[model samples]
Structures are given as structure tokens and as C-alpha cells.
Target: MRINQPQLIDSTLREGEQTPSVAFTDQDKHKIIQGLCRIGVDEIELGIASPLNTYLPNLVKEAKKITAGSCRLSLWCRCKAEDIAFAATCFPDLLALSIPVSDPHIQERLGKDRDWISKTLTASLQQAWAAGIPAVSVGMEDASRADTDFLVATAKIAQQHGATRIRLADTVGICSPARMTRLVQTMKEAVSLPVAVHCHNDFGMATANSIAALEAGADSLDATVLGLGERAGNCRLEEVIGYLALVLGEQRYHPEFLPELCQLVAESAGRDIAENHPLVGSAIFTCESGLHQHGLTVNPDMYEPYAPERVGGTRRLRFGEKTGARAIQLQLHKAGLRLDEMQIKDLVHRIRSGGQVLNQEQLLRFAAKCC
Candidate 1:
């Protein structure tokens, strides 16, 4: 199947702040926005446009300056006339008005019915338009669990109400890739408006589901840096962009900017980037297993999906207890040192007995001393 090149909407400034104990200062937000723009994302969701968030207007202004109109800036708001009215004051390029479409959220949470959902959504879109908002999107919260028929109906209503886009959110991260594909396909067939997917990572399928949605013809995907958000967080910006650029061969995004961008977000969130984190981790391209090291020594492509430099990473081999004799010989040969088989075997035993991982320089020094 031909993969669609989808627009990326990075929501780090908005959804990422929902992470516990995370509050990005103005400087942090500006830096993140600049970083995101450098990566060439299509849009950025700044934050909620509530009156309490007094910095939103200025944030939007600064984002405009940073992006210089190359990227669109958006503000999120609830499905209320007041929220739409306030969000218009921020002068964002787009306003995303969100409401629940599932039975649980509509009936139990909001104490309302589907009819009220349609009414409120219609009113919200109209209000945003009346307030002179240039573009508007309607988000269906808990859409993964919503009835398929009702979801189609709601999307049609959103389209009829002049929404430029419709966002389907996996509110609790219950969707598998197959489910997300079906949902996006159905919505695409039902509405002419652009379809966007927002997936959560409670089940660790946000990135998978998001890719599935794009393959099924979603027009956009929502993501956050480092996957920072409530609970298990949202789809990771780096993971999605990396797959698009490296695997799908999409040239619109720059995955090489991910390392620095993710580092900035991790520091602001007071979170540590796991060494094995896909795409931008410090050690993702580092090898320790003896078998893998041998493959890398022969042809890095045998073990690596792509060159580490594709994402601004470097390939590194570490020697340890797991290192095989052939890998040690290969490393020693690269350093212009040769040893007899017996000597190499004895050195391997000693290194394994030591039970420590050694870098290239350390392994070379150790081999010189022992051999």
C-alpha cells in the first residue's frame, strides 16, 4: 500500500504540559516551538485558550514570529461558545474545539445526549467562525470507543458545520492499529473534511495506531515530544517523524533535528530519556550483544534499520561479557593489533570474567596490556 504523507500537528506545548509535575516556562515553550519549527511540522497546538492562561495570546504572537508563517499555530478549546469566543482573542491560525462522541462521555460524563453533542458542536463551529477564526477543527473525544454509526454521523455534522478538520482521539488508549485503521477509513469515507488522529500511549500503541491511521488515509497525526502528556502520554513526535522520514521516505520532515528537540523537552518535563527509546535515545544505536556486534562489524545494515546519522546518532560498539571472540578479534584488528588464537581466547575469558562493558578505546588498551 502507498503510504500517505500526513501533516504532523505537534502538541507538546499543550498536551505535554498535562504530564504530572510538568510546567513549561515561557522560555521553555518558545524554545520548544522553535525546535518544532526547525523540524518542519505542519502545525503546533500551543495550549488551551482559557482566560486563566493569560500568556496564550503572547505565546501565539511569539510562535508566529518564530515560525514566520511557515507553520500554523492552533489553540485548543472546549465545545462552548465562551471558549470559542476567548480562543479567538488569541489570534491563532486555527482553533480546535473538542467534545465527547462516545456514549460514556456524552451521557455519563457530560450528562448529555447525542443530540446535545450535535447542537453544541454546531454552535461551537458557528461561534468560532463568527469570531473571525480563520480555521476550525472539531475533535471527537473517546472516539475509539464511540459507535461507528454515531461517529460517522458526528463527522458529517462537523463537515456540514464547516470544520476544516475532524480529530478522532483514543481518549484512554484502547485502540489497536487495526481498530484505528478502520475508524480512520470510515471517517474518511463519511466526511470530506480532513481527518486527524490523536492517540494516547496507555497501551504503548499510540505510534502504531497513528501510523495505521495515516496508512488508512488520515490527513494528519497529533504527537508530543517524548510522548509527554497525561498517564502514559501521547504519540511521540520523534517516533512518528522518524518513521515517516526513514521508513516511508517522506522528505517533508527532518528527523535529524529530533535528538536536540527531544532533549530539550525531556529536561523541561523533568523526565529522563530512556536509553532504548526509539529514534532519539542516546544508546539506541549502541551495540553490546556479541552476535549483533559481529553483524554491525560486517555490515551495519544487517542489524540497523537505517544509518544512525539519519537521526543525528552515531553507531558505537561496546565490549563486555557478552562479547564473542570473533568480535574481539575484529576490534583488535581494526586497532592494528593481532594475537594468536590461544592468546585471544584467554583474553576473552579474562574480560568476560571481569564482567564490565568496555568502549573501543578501553578494549584496545586492555588488549594491549594482556596480549
Candidate 2:
């Protein structure tokens, strides 16, 4: 299952910060950057270079010092001179200039035509290059919605203007995996530079689309911790890296750090992680169903796709109304307790009648009192 190691461009700060009411302080930024570096991500987009805030420069400096060149830092900007100029002052390893490619976004948002977009993008890239930025990544906003020919042409123009990479942004997350694969493949065939993908989660397919892009020939992928972004969110950092490891057999990232990183990002964003969040969720590794518990007891792999430890998690069997006698026995044995058949049967009956899930402490107390 070995495959090419696609570079991970974690956009937690740039995109995740865009989540409603989410803001990261200097300390929060540093912690996130440090964790991303420790996990060996290829790059991190710090934030947009506009607004010229007093804290942004200091944040970029602190991030640089923290990373110490272990991971690359990139800055996002609009297709405007001022944005690029200000981003250049941050001294990021790469500057990502965004341009609207779709007709709707172009005509509605910018009130410009396709020709205008191309010219503006060309000028922006030239400006960024003239500023002597280390590198430039062109962000094709609404790329998935744009016409394929126009998208490819835009990428070509960007390359002509010295863009080091072309980021295909699924701005609305309306792309399916099949569409993603086709678009990425077409872009790869048309462009010479690396093609990266930034997917949103409006359709709950950002992760699938990103992986599809990778399989189609993309060089890098963008993600945010917990998929925190505008609307539904973006591709989840933990989910993408974990999928690469457990399914695709790529192991460059340190999955063990995801739990801590997830907590850090969630705390910074002031958001609660759902119990069903794929990688760092509290209930992802918790088993409750009788069939699942039985399979897990026999062999974890029989029921679980991968071990919980693979993503810095632990497995726990929940005793609930669905608890079978064998599952209760397994739980009791795991808790280092022994019970006769009658006691076990009685306990199963009580659990089934309780009509709710019981935690380890409650189960332990029950077992001790009954058996």
C-alpha cells in the first residue's frame, strides 16, 4: 500500500482561524505551530497578511523562531499589491496569493471578467516575485467550480509569473471524489508546477476529495485541525494524516501527537470536539454494540479499522442496554474481576434494564457489590 508522500500544508491558522468567533492568541499560535512542526508537517500557513495588525508580525517572528526552519511557513494574501507587499514583510517561506477563478465569483464578487482575473493574477504574482519573496503559491479560489480549461489556463499564467505551486481550492466544498480526481488529474497534465488542493467541508467530502486529489497526482494537501474553517470546515488535519497512515501506508506524520494537538486547537478556538470526531473524538474508540464488542474481544482489527493507539487513543468497552452476556464478561475480565455464571447473568439483566451506558467505575462498583 505504499504511495507517494504528499506534502501536508496545514492551514490551521489561516483557515481554522476563519471559523466563526475563533481567534488564536500569540501563545496559541506558537503552540499550534510547535505541534505541527513536531508532527513533521511540510508547511504551515500562518495567516493572511492584510489588516497589518500589531500582533501578526510578532506572531510570525515567534513562529519562525519556534519552527527554526524545521517546517516551512507560508502567508496568505489576496490578488492585490498591498496584500502581497505586507505578506512579503513577514518573511514567510512562501506567499499564497488568492484569485477568484469561477465566473460567478469573478463577476459577482469582484465584478470582473475572466480576462480581468488573469491580468490581476499575473500582476499579483509579478508583484510578489518582484518583492523578492522566497516563493509564491497561487491560490485559485473556487477552482472546482471554474471551467477546467480556464482553471488550467490560470495555473499556466501563474506559473508563467513565477508561482512555485498552484493551490486548487474547493471553495464551496461542492466537489465529489470523482470530480476531484478528474480535476486534479487534468490540472497535473496541464501544469508543470506542483498542484495542491484546499478543500472545504460544506458537503462533508473535504477529506475524501483531498485524498482523491492525492491519488490523482496532487503534490500537497491543505487541512485544518478538527476541520475548523468557515461554514462546515475544511479537510481535517488529523483525519487526512491518519487515513494516509492506516489506509495508504504513508507514515511521515506522528499520529500520536494528534490528540494533544486537537485539544490545543479546540481550546484556542473555544469549540468543543464532537464525540464522533474521527480521530480525536472521545467516543471513536469506545465500543458498545454486542457484535462489535465480541469482534473486538476476539481481535481488535476484526471490528476496528485500526488500533486506537495509532491515533493516540484508547479502546474502552461500554456496558449498556445492548451489552451481551459475553461482552459483560469481557468487560469484567478486563477490569480484573471474576464472577460466577449466575452473578454474570444477573448483572447483564440489570445492565439491560438500566437503559443507559455505564462507565467503568459504575460497572466496577456493581461487580464488586454483586459478585
Give the winner by lDDT.
1
The predictions' CA RMSDs to the true structure, in order, are: 1.1, 2.1
Query: Scored by CA lDDT, what does every candidate get?
Result: 0.92, 0.88
User: TM-score of predicted model 1?
Assistant: 0.97
User: How well is each residue in 20-74 modelled by candidate 1, as lDDT tens digits?
Assistant: 9999999999999999988999999999989888899899989899999999999
lDDT per residue, candidate 2, 247-274, as tens digits? 7777677888888999999988888999
> How do all models score by TM-score?
0.97, 0.93
